[model samples]
Target chain A: MNWKRLAPPLAVLVLWQAGSTAGLIPGFKLPSPLQVLGGLADLALRGMPPGHRLHVHVLYSLERVLWGYGLAVLVAVPLGILMGWSRRVRDWIEPLVEILRPIPPLAWIPIAILWFGIGIRSAAFIIFLGAFFPVLLNTVSGVRSIDPLLIEAAQMLNAGRRFIFLKVLLPGSVPSILTGMRIGIGIGWMSLVAAEFTGVRQGYGLGYMIMTARDIQRPDEILAGMLVIGLIGLGIDGGLRLAERRLVRWR
Target chain B: MALHLEIEAIQKVYPSESPEGRVEVFHRIDLSVDPGQFVSIVGPSGCGKTTLLRIVAGLEARTSGRILLDGRESEERDRRIGMVFQDYALFPWRTAVRNIEIGLEIQGMPQQKRRSLAMKYVRVFGLEGFADKYPKELSGGMKQRVAIARTLVANPEVVLMDEPFGSLDSQTRNRLQDFLLRIWRERKDTILFVTHNVDEAVYLSDRIAVLSPRPAAVCGIFDVALERPRDRTGPEANRIRKEILELLHRPHTSPVTF
Candidate 1:
């Protein structure tokens, strides 16, 4: 919304265009924006590989992210709230989560392939791990940050434990929960590329197509695939920002 | 509804690091408010005035004592109590009207009935224009008005205020005092107001209870006896204020039970 904030990206684009025009980049190594767009148009209209349009590749990755991120939210949010609200739960799980969280989601790829065997399910599992930690950790932080006075006020108003949890704790932690979900979605999206790079079958995801293009020596197609990934990632992030602005009207 | 209140020998002590390693805050304090009588507690800071009020409100427990409301001991009964906090303590997320209706909503009152009741107080306090506005949107005095309206919406039997106007400017405080006096006169429910301001104590109270410092004990209770609608700048009010201030300033020593 602020033009001044957007100047960096505009300047980078201008520099890239200038560098390409001045022949600073070797043609085989670096394609101009126009060349990338032309290759992108070709990939979008004509099939990238075996009846798979670039849009289909994007949709394949998107489907995996949605399922994984959705499941992560369903499981992690309540667990995070429980861990935050009670000391016993936190003590029991905190150590396990701490040790596991530092391990990148990609590190689980071998186990995921062994368990689910080179399919969408394997990809979804890796994406789930990517999303889960961010949402869970952020949700816990959010609940802990709530003001004690608000809790006292709810207590004085004769709110029961259930009512307080639902009405006070949940709404109070919403902004933080949303923040966690946004971070989780982004991480999950990033993890999907690696997840799809494994032995996926019956479909071409953006990750799969990028690898295939690299093998076939179509660097332009590889660049186009990377551009699509960046654009889609940016779009998802923008959607979250819009939702955050609308939902956190109080904040 | 009327409240026949009783406080039977309430004692409070806090741990300290002196020769005794403990200090008595309040000592076997006994007081009672008759049905519909407005009693005000005046004392210096750190005198456990607010502690005493909290004990009565059931927000805190006494060291050893009993509080009876209408002849029965105050247990976990909801007693139709109202509280106006010094900081206004309105929920930041709720609008003025919503804040006023919060107690009713908790009681599961229907939305229309709650709104109707909340609207009456909103109109009475000249807060109709700001009914839909949040606490942050209102000025200090306006927020206090909303707080009073919020308390009054429940039609509470006993309204406990802890320095309700302590944070406001002098002009707003005076205006709110006059407004409070009018509300008390009209409603006449049992009101226990705790304040450190001597002028405010005499101006609004039917009877002023002066409390001692630190290990708080009630030194004495003085009947205001000044005329109603007592103007802050009026001669009678000034005389009463000076008398109350003199009582508050007196150095008294008595052996208080821990």
Candidate 2:
């Protein structure tokens, strides 16, 4: 059914290849399409660093997102549920979340490095900041938005509080929570570039590759790194779409 | 038939700070139903027919008065009770069989046992081919069938239906009415059907209770003495329909479908 959806992207790719071959795109600041492709192959075979592969950079970025986003889900979902269920918890936690959420995640990087000492922990912390609020707010709204009649129906059918929570509330809020996860992942990806810029002092990732390439005026490598990041982000969202289809099929 | 349920002096007050201090949705509403009876509550839109049913089903707390089941006051909903909502409320994430399995699952029936029981009702409701389909995948009529099958499979002592067919088109509504009559006759299930449609109330109910405007009270209760599978266009049916419409003076207030 989505076969027609591919046409626009393909057309853009064709135009990009044509523009590159015709030298219509400036070579100094941008790479030709073929040069970018070649750059990708070069990185795959022999990476920017001594022994690391292209997959390593990708995995580093992905692993950071997984840990950060996973931690956000783990922490925020329960807190959101508690806030949704009880006025006391909501009132207590509301001010803190509201205050902290508005500040962009990059603002926290310097403090995160000071707190976490500049490595994977620091990167994960910043990404977590980027992701936590979306999941928390969405879960809260999801739980709040449940049709009360559904809960009443469950109770009328003899469901205990625990059963109603697990069966009625959780399933009812799933579509909303899934929406939160999608948005959270995108933000997590965006923050990955900034998070990795925090001077890890060891192996570098795609973000570091882009930064180092910019210093060397190798836009080809920068474009290739960006392509990988974009492609991987697309893949992650694609996985979520598949899960949305499987888990929330009725919607 | 034995007296099955008695709702006595029921009152519901929606807390408000208006000049009257609080808005009373309904008060001192008294009614009783016998076992194996089909009763319909018909009224204008705001007469609280639904609120009365929900109170009877124990989904909402009554401000005062007692609900007697088998001659004893009890606030807890009977496990042997089921309700069909106006929206069908089929749990969009579940298939037809799984939706029907909720009641049994709450009863702690084993998975295989519940599945088979659901399958049986799927056939009973002529939902054979659509059992595995999700609620959105089915037509309006089909979804309503699944909702009914879900409640009937519970083998409830009383089934409360709140404008269940209000969402269907006229043709589907008539067909479902016939299908429901067949099922009701076969099981002799006690039902408290709520609606605003005078024709529907007069046609399906053994006793039709007319409800007055807000702070809903039972205006009157008239018995339908016609034979089984009563003709919709028959003279007696027509007379009862007209009488019921006149009784529910704020008539033709069909609840919005979906």
List the candidates' TM-scores in order.
0.91, 0.90
Lowest lDDT sum, 10 consecutive residues, model 1 chain A, at A150-159
Clashing pairs for model 2 are none
Best candidate according to DockQ: 2
Please report the TM-score between candidate 2 and the true structure: 0.90
RMSD of 2: 4.4
After TM-score superposition, what is the CA distance of residue A247 in candidate 1 from its true location, in Å?
A: 2.1
Off by over 4 Å in 1: A1-8, B16-21, B77-79, B251-258
Poorest 10 consecutive residues by lDDT, candidate 2 chain B: B246-255
Compose the digit string of candidate 1's lDDT tens values, residues A1-251: 79999999889878887898899976578777777878788779875674688888888888888888899999999999998898899999899999999999999999888898887888889889999999999999988888866665555555567867887778778899999999999999999997887757866798998887777767778899998898898999999989998887766
Give one digit per residue, the lDDT tens place, for model 2 in B129-240: 8888998899999999988888777777888899999989999999999999999998887888999898888789999888898777888899999998889999999988
True interface contacts retained by model 2: 0.68
* Candidate 1 lDDT tens digits, B76-101: 73456667888887777678998888
Give DockQ for candidates 1 onward, in order: 0.42, 0.60
Native-to-model Cα distance after best TM-score fit, residue A196 in candidate 1, in Å: 2.2
